[model samples]
Target: MTRLLGFPIADHRRVFIIALPMIISNIAAPLLGLVDTAIIGHLPDAIYLSAVAVGATVIGFIYFLAVFMRMSMTALVAQNFGADDMAAQRHNSINGLFLAALLGVLLILLTPAVLELSWWLMVPAPALQNLASDYISIRLWGAPAALMNLVILGVLLGRQQSRQAMWLVIATNAVNVIVDVWLIVILDWRVQGAAVASAAAEWSSCLLGLFWLRKSLALGWHHLRLNLKQLLVLLRLNGDIFVRSLTLQLCMASMTAYATRYGAIYVAVNAVLMQFLLLISLGLDGIAYAVEALVGQAKGQGRSDRVRHWCRLTLLWSCLFAVAYSLIFIAFGEHIIRLLTDIDSVIDTAGHYLPWLMVLPLIGHWSYYFDGVFIGLAQSRGMRNTMLFAALLGFLPLWWWGQRFENHGLWLALTGFLMMRGVAQAIWLKRHPQTLL
Candidate 1:
């Protein structure tokens, strides 16, 4: 309903322009995990597959915690861009990189303790634990590069330069796939090969991102100084986002732990299904990312009407994609599951739960969309609180009751978590519409 020059704005075109490249980039992301899974799945040892699965999940949790850097950077940069404040944008980029570097180093230093704690919590089979530990240890080396890349990607997305962002993602995943195939399949190095492939890819992308940033921004070194007030604001925004991400990760980790308790077969099955879930979420997140940039820009320009219009269009596209994705999963999930693993037990177990994957998009797409809207509006506190309530009140309680149903209970709890997130956030936003202003 946004009008320009007495005509309706073609916001869909704007959304698609940003969202399309991101969708491809996001799809490529899960392919990295799938390649690792497939390569290890064929290695004649279920432990190898389970090890990579658990290790990746643990590393994912760690990396996800730092996602606030990306989210906050995106919001800050987009708003600055809208106001034509190139200086603020430059400051944000530099600060984000610095923060990412600091966090990445801290993660590296804490690797031993993290691995110890993760193993204690996961309690995988002995063989699985050892292999997983090795994977986590090796991948931790890339933490600095990986976190920096997140900031770089955030900068690109915030600028509405999604094409470059897409290229970066493609290049990164291409490296991951090539290395994974050569080391895991050809050399038969197993889980270690996959970890090495991922680490190598992370550093590769980081370097590429640095080169791109230098060329794109062309900023002098003098422009990179940190602003204390902005840093404080960034920290507060990221703090809320960190808590939100933590709660979400807790739900994911809890699901993994519950699945692990059912034995390696279930763990592997859940991992495969999780890939599908990741694929959907990331794809939907593409739309959300587009919304963030567009809405943040509008908000910065003091155009509340434009922000609302963009949000409406984004949600419509998200719903359409959700319906389409659900159908595709219902039709071809079995085929996809088989492609991910050759272990017959893993394949069978995953197929039995394919229905959950099919319905997940419909139930969860709104949360992804809403997250973008909130981030664009700098409503991190609402995001943090909504996730807390959803995880603790909605997910944990449901999980407790659903545990009686075994894996079914686990899936149900997860579904509740996703649905509750969207519902709670919706209610909160409705009650406090000023947050969007």
Candidate 2:
């Protein structure tokens, strides 16, 4: 009789169980970024750390561009699964892999041009700029493998295998840590080592993901066909995801650019805080992904009752997790930030922002939950439109105010950004309850 969110989680423990591995895996993904920052931040000069920040943040957006494919694949496959069409689900997985490969090539070609433009980005020191160049040039090689990993994880989620997804994350990170040690400490490769390590980890995961995806799809392998009808469905679904992703990535790129206005230290400090924010936000988002798969499939099966139940459990656990974790962070937030970097200035700056950072998760739970629900119901247009408005109306104006007010403006804008995005998306959800499944 105990409540999970608004539902009896006792009967739906499987959904939470399915999301657990993803939660841990999402946590690990951030650890990789943190490790890179820690290693580079501890180097003799601040330039080294700032260089990694510039380079990594730039490429992180690149990595996010592939997110649409991942989200789209998850929605499509989950719907197929709920329809009890194993063949269609398998086909969607394959479609995702092919699409990832195609996009990988496009990203690879865009690299040299991106680097040339990256040079124009407002990095204060030349040393940092060079480091950014080296890191970007080397890491761009992994675009294909990285994108493939996204698809693989999406398919596994569609099939309700979050444990496997988590295991893959663990295995991939192990490779990264080991390789990072060899390159950074052993060979003294510095910032470039971290970049290489990230790419290597993705390639390793892509290999394993291929193996797992193949086995999963082999069940319906015989029914695989690349017909026009399925292609249209995949393209349309993925197209919306792409637009949605572009808007999201633009918001990130804009954030970094806007921060760059305050000079490299602000950008650098923000870069670290953004990593922490991503780690915490996405870690909470693992629950949303759980809701996405469950609700999407439930919709397909016309199991409206189960969809509502899943949403209740997900929202409950996510808010509780956010509150509990944020409290622990409030208690030891600065202590934890200190461990990641020895730079006293950056540490102080990050801590100043840490309290406001805490509110982000709570205010954002609604949007994250709605995103999952909309994806599950394949309501990408609603998701896309709402985010577009948030970024353009909610964030940009707030950022403009931040610029006008000096330093305080950015912090207020960021907080406003989180609050507005969540509220705007909730409004959209109200108009489109079906997206809630």
Candidate 3:
């Protein structure tokens, strides 16, 4: 019954227990990109870094469009965990894996067309296009593993098995970094080396995740039988989240596409700046993930009070973390950019836009926190609606009007998009107070 920071020690302990490992894990996720960028950035031409950036953006566009698998699994499995329904948890995992596999195969099949369309739209320099295509061609092979890994991660986090999830992600990215150094740095494989390293890591992590979850995965044959009702529930939730995720990725990819119009310098600069944004968003997502599990559990137990309590705590922790990120970026943004690249033009161009990155955490944390809350409650409709509103009404207009400013305009659009999501989510929560139940 002891208290700390206006909450019981037990409450605080539970939050940190679920959050710390995730914070570490999610932070490492973006750090992997930073490692990739740093490795590629040191090459003789800025073109290599630009190629990797374009390649990554295109692949991410495809993969993240399907991240609904991970989001839905976490919400569903967490609720099952709260209800102490072990069998249902296993069932959800199995169905999610099946869905993930199917989607992965579809992505692979569409790769040739996607690559052609992506480059056609972006239309970068001829050399950049070829190098990026080289990276994409190899990277797509890991789609199945990467998608499968997302389900594995969702199940682990939903079960509150944060330590296992953390290890899986860390080990995966560690392999990636090591391979990047060997293939890209030592062998000088250029952009293709980075692609192989990432693809290898994805497949390795998929195997490792299965190993870690072997016990939970081992179920009676009956549990493998798909229940149409439960599967429908999963599909419905994932469908909403899919729309939300796709919209979000389109906004992100649009920024990259717009940046290309300004030349390779802008594209390279945006790529470097984006890493800072990713570091902040993914790091803050740790707190959001905790909120998701806890809130979902509380909802399963029919404890509306606990739901509200966790939501409030999510806001508080997210704010503190956002402030910390803003301060760090403001103080050391240039220093960080310098470490990522030796190219003087990239360094200077990225510095010009670091201010946008510095303030993004403050503008964006609310939507992230609210996203966790809604996902926990299995109310992805709200998330989908808010994201659409932000992208359409806020981001597009801002970008159109600000186009004369070039790269700065793109950043401005992104800022508007993120801020709109947070504001809209806040308003939605206020209006639908009953969602806590």
Candidate 4:
């Protein structure tokens, strides 16, 4: 237990307060995808599900790359709050939204190139590619709105306004799910309908977030002016995060591509399995988000002891949750698989892959927790280097050799990648003890 003012304090309450809303938000984030999957999976053909998988994977890659905006904004805002620098916090919020708008437009403009490049790399079948193209085209239009929401959400989390952030996420995802069902099931618009629903929900969230920020921070347009030096720092921080995100996205895209090579059934199976993994990762990330704000604040206040205390408590909670998740997966993996897709073939194939899913929580929790710690500290370089090492030295080569094992090999390589990420980051922390302290 940590002590303050000569009294013992329970860290779990503090941590849980920050984490609970985020846990709901994080879980809701993936439930959006799961909803899309469940909606599309019931269609007569597996192609609809496969197309959604590939299209969503590509868009997810692009959007995730822009996640630097969210991560950087949270850390900067949290640090500013810790230092009692209201002006700087407001400035960061304004500039973050501005940057997000810029990046969003760029993503929209590059849609054609992105689609061309994605098709080239993925080499999906003609029918599947056509459906995927339709999906991506519509979804790309939402990039700006989606990215803007990321920045706003970051600001909320950084300020420890978790309840507000939680409601925003819940509302946004609820809109997506309702619209998705109406458009796809009621109107029979299929893949394009899913895209439209997502875009509408994204824009709604962005607008709602801006409205919330206006009331919460009372921000003024005059404060949105660009600062070249601050912009440089933002870019530098986001640049490192970009590299880190790129490597992570590459690992993900590679998994999808490799799975595609195995056949559409495998691709669909992998897609469903990946959702389970996403659910676990996002749930764990709730804790990481809490750590990001808490650690960043601690760092800003020069409270090294508080930082250490947070790290210990967060790691303990993460391990316990990982155990709980593993047990749940082990017991209900088949039932969950069946729930995601009604197709006997897809369900049966995914069942064969359940063991990997069952074990993933245990192996992957460390890397996820450390990610929050590093992001909170705003130490992007270590994250970048470790991911590079993990992807290039650990995952890719292992994936190559594991090809003999087919889909099993792919899962094995991914497992190795997760383990290596945690191990390498641990070594990095050992070498630089000041980060945690």
Q: lDDT by residue for model 4 over 1-437, one digit each (tens)?
A: 78743334666777778899988777776667677689989888899889988998898878888899999988888777777788878778878888989988888899899999999887999999999999999998999889988899888988888888898888888898999999999999998998899899999988999999987777777776876666777788899889989888778767777887888898898889988877786669888988898888887788888888778878887898899899999998898888889999999888888999899999999999999888888788898999999999889999999999989999988999999999998899889988764
lDDT of 3 by residue, 154-191 (tens): 89888888888899989888999999999999999988
lDDT of 3 at 78: 84
lDDT ranking, high to low: 1, 3, 4, 2
Expressed as tens digits, the lDDT of each residue in 1-437 for candidate 1 is 98653335676678878999998888876677576577779899788888988898898878878899889988888888777788788888888888888888888899889988997776788888889999999999899999999899888888899999999989888898899999988998889999999999999999999888877777787877888888888889999999999888878877777787888788888878888877687679889999899998888887888888888888888998899999999898998898888998888778888889999999999899999999888888999999999998889999999988889899999999999999999999899977657
Give the TM-score of each candidate. 0.86, 0.85, 0.87, 0.87
> Model 4, clash count?
0
The residue-by-residue lDDT of candidate 2 on 44-144, one tens digit each, is 87876777777877887777776888788888888888888877887777777777888887778888888877776554467667788888887888888
Candidate 3: global Cα-lDDT? Answer: 0.86
| RMSD (CA, Å), each prediction | 3.6, 3.4, 3.3, 3.5
lDDT of 3 at 311: 83
For candidate 2, the lDDT comes to 0.77
Q: What is the lDDT of residue 277 in candidate 2?
A: 70
lDDT of each: 0.87, 0.77, 0.86, 0.86
